[model samples]
Target: MEQRLASPLLQISGLTRHFGGLPALDQVSFQVAEGRVTALIGPNGAGKTTLINCLSGVLEPDSGTIIFQDRDITGLSPHQVARLGIARTFQNLRIFPRMSVLDNVLCGLTVQAGGSLLEALLRTPGLRHRERRLKLTALEALDSFGLGDKAGWPAGALSYGDKKRVEMARAFVSQPVLILLDEPVAGLNPEETAQIAALIRQMRVYGKTMLLVEHDMDLVMGVSDHVVVLDGGCRIAQGPPDEIQVNPLVLEAYLGRMSATA
Candidate 1:
């Protein structure tokens, strides 16, 4: 189990999104505790992806208040949210095909760079020093995921699993306060899933807050400190894995049939 903090790191109240007059997320509310893994799981068309998009600033919620670390961050731009110590990986891998593995990770660290415009323009000693330091840091991040040897290769040249690891390295390099992982194990084999699971545990060990949207129930049950379920864009159930597993509403959401006890 994750060692969650005393107070919520994120508080979302009355979060709603719609398209063409159809609701995608309807009055969703939840609190993600700091230093814990919160799994967001639901059936198909449950708006899990949409919620992640809204949180990461990819899609604005029609109405809601998103409070992160005690500040209202609703409607912030993507870069603005990122600079505030929020980072994410997509359900689909987003990478520059031609960029080297190292470069892909390097791009994420740009937000943490410390060279003033004048120093950069002058190519001062300080600017060069920072660049060298960034390279070393990037290399160290890659090495942690066993990708150091492949850092010179084009990102597109790696297998899908390796590419995901690179994306994870990119997310972790900056040491963000929170990471939103969308379907992190969506298309991997058992071996690859195990690899990612191990890495997720490593992130927890380092005290990272994670909001996960994934379909792998076993993975969610094994790794999540808390699980929140959604159905037709509304939050239906939330608790530890065992409680969620037995919740009649959850079973009905996925099976489309309510139990006699429900």
Candidate 2:
């Protein structure tokens, strides 16, 4: 069955990035439809991470354009991108081990935290009210991710699975329009993988647009409404998951390797 994609929320046209004269992303282009899960899949070194970095403004593209919400955002900074309603999680966990879970989630609110320095210094009534409201919102986010009880615990004290949930809660706390998830299920057990897959679906149900780079074919096929395949830093195939799964290029470049390794 063909998947019906929503209107395009993000458009990448001729996005190229290089490291040391080698193209990490060579003219890659794709559209992420609004309110859908778009999976970017390829073998390692296929520019998946580079594309994600470029979209999230961690690295500027050497050439090409990135359009978000119909705005030209090609070279925006990470904070600028975040303030414009895009949030991302890292391939490697970026949690603050020493900080409390609630504090860690609060970090995401910086994009929405608006106040003058003098107002904060004086702790005005409005500032206090806003702070309280933000804290409540953070607590609600934790509760949604099933970490409400551990909100006061040191982030490092949680188990690996719980830590992953904490990262998810923090990334989503700010309620960004688009979420970039990079290898969201890396190093998880089967149970944890299933949990994360369900969470991904839940996010879509709530109307969050997502673009994820992942190697877990099962999770990708299970949750993705649209799939884009990249190989050697170029887009090779893209479409519904069923079509992408049988694509000759994808089979030769991605799944064939998994079959051989297994």
Candidate 3:
């Protein structure tokens, strides 16, 4: 495999998140390289979600600098960050259950549409053309995720794994430069997990950078080019899979508890 050299797509410096008096994330910092999959792994309650939430503007960090593509976006709103091409899928699936899969994906493209609510309601000529293009794009995204055939189906009718896949399709429909995936393969069977992993690898080929917060060690170790391990809201280790797998701190953080039980 040929390696591509590119600058970091995301940079975090001294990021801290606190819930009242308890700190969930403490000055955590890392960089997500362009066109590469960076895995964020940690034991439960290690603040992975907190960090991601702050990065995605779901939560505001107390103090920190979040730079994307060299622009400071530390306290930007979620909508603001998203408009800058930073997209994310939640740890819990957040699809519109009552909507069709195609419509669910089409929501991602609404940011690019040009029109007021009245124009959209009236189906004006310009808005109609834009809607047609968005639908085509949404369909293409679904096809890429192997869900094109189910485009018209209600999202709630899909299996859990399929819903997860649909969420991924919706996130990518916006053509984001950086995508944060939170436990994307959670609750998936082996086959579904494998498919999701493959899809993640494919994203790299498509030149989309990924920051994956996943607990499945096999998937993280197998597909990630770099991995960051967190424990108790602090970074324990960060390196390639080969190094992360053997780091004593990482092993101690995850496997040490198992050993204590044993």
Q: Mark the regions of model 2 whose C-alpha exceeds 4 Å error after superposition.
A: 1-6, 114-129, 259-262
What shift in Å separates residue 178 of candidate 3 from its native position after superposition? Answer: 0.1
Going through the candidates in order, what is the number of backbone clashes in each?
0, 0, 0
TM-score of each: 0.89, 0.91, 0.91
- Model 3: clashing residue pairs? none
Model 2's C-alpha root-mean-square deviation from the true structure amounts to 3.3
Decreasing lDDT order of the candidates: 2, 3, 1
Model 1: weakest 10-residue lDDT segment is 253-262
**Tens-digit lDDT track for model 3 on 101-185?**
9987877676534333345345567766678878898999999999999999999999999999998987888899888999999
lDDT of 1 by residue, 116-198 (tens): 33343455676566777778899999999889999999999999999999888888888889899988998999999999998
**Residue 115 shift from truth in candidate 2, angstroms:** 7.7
- Residue 202 miss distance in model 2 (angstroms): 0.7
Quote the lDDT for 172 in model 2.
92
The local distance difference test score of model 1 is 0.85
Steric clash pairs (candidate 1): none
